[model samples]
Target: MKRLVLLLTFLCPMGFIALNAQSSSIFIGATGGANLSKFKFTEDLKELYPASNSLLGLNGGVTIGFEVQNFTLHTGLQYIQKGSEYQTDNFEDEQGTGFYSATEKLHYLSIPLLIGYRKYL
Candidate 1:
């Protein structure tokens, strides 16, 4: 728990730095958007696994972005998690009172890159 607190302490501040970097070219603003949730089954199979976006349903959050040259980078704090349900079909009873359910709380940070168009007034 302490390690997680330590890591988040450093990482969240990095977001603050990204907000303050290059005052001339960088502008920070709040953003919200749709996000997909996925789970990690292994480290080497990020591309191979069928990413289940519907596992935890839709998610939304606020983000901060900065413009560097023609590229804009966005980082967000998201409320999201991976979830699942377990069930079995049986000839004895199609509908059974016996079923299992579980939920996990998740917290995450997201980052994205967006190409930018600039206009001066």
Candidate 2:
């Protein structure tokens, strides 16, 4: 069935890579870090949201790399948290509605692929 072929197409490569972890040309590693995020506003808008603070977040991921001669390929899967906590200045809208403060939190999954060439100095 087409489903079976599709499944195998993806799974086969993973199997080969797992089995070949001992190969010198292939490497696997973990990555992790912290992130500080905040928002910036232009001069005009700055007056409307005069106060803000950086939000602290986390990021982590696994990376896989393959090397061939002088060329290399890298890819990874990662989790990231982003957004900020912000407050608005005491400003009234046309209808006189006042706004105060709020925090925004966001979560994301990241997939990145990169290719590189190494030159010996």
Candidate 3:
């Protein structure tokens, strides 16, 4: 749910750019990057628990584009890994009191499309 929203937040601008692009010469390229992410719990959860730590992740993909003069239209597919490390100290429940550590990971397939116009000074 939240993840989906976050994904869309990241992709929507690119989609809007792609839809508005005015270019036609094709070009191909590769893209890769590392991402650091953390879990952002809801207010309800935060009231009762500590925030989680960020985890390092990686993303890689291929990009295709169309260029016309100074303008370009681009699109790509990427593999993304998002994760976080969580720890709780003196966590108490009906069972008992203890410390806990957990790691979470999620994988996503993303497609980003955008248009760019470059100018030289």
Q: For residues 12-66, write the lDDT of model 2, one tens digit per residue.
A: 6875675466443878999999999887778987888888889999999999998
Q: Model 3 over residues 1-121: C-alpha lDDT tens digits?
A: 9999999899978755765575456789999999999999898776445858999999999999977677777898989999999877757756676676789999999999797998968
Give the per-residue lDDT of model 1 (tens digit) for 67-89: 64444666666544445332322
Task: Work out how many backbone clashes candidate 1 has.
Answer: 0
Worst 10 residues of 2 by lDDT: 15-24
Q: Which stretches of candidate 1 lie over 4 Å from their true place?
A: 1-56, 89-121
Global CA lDDT computed for model 3: 0.83
Candidate 1 global TM-score: 0.36
Report lDDT (Cα) of residue 26, candidate 2. 79
- lDDT agreement of model 2 with the native: 0.83
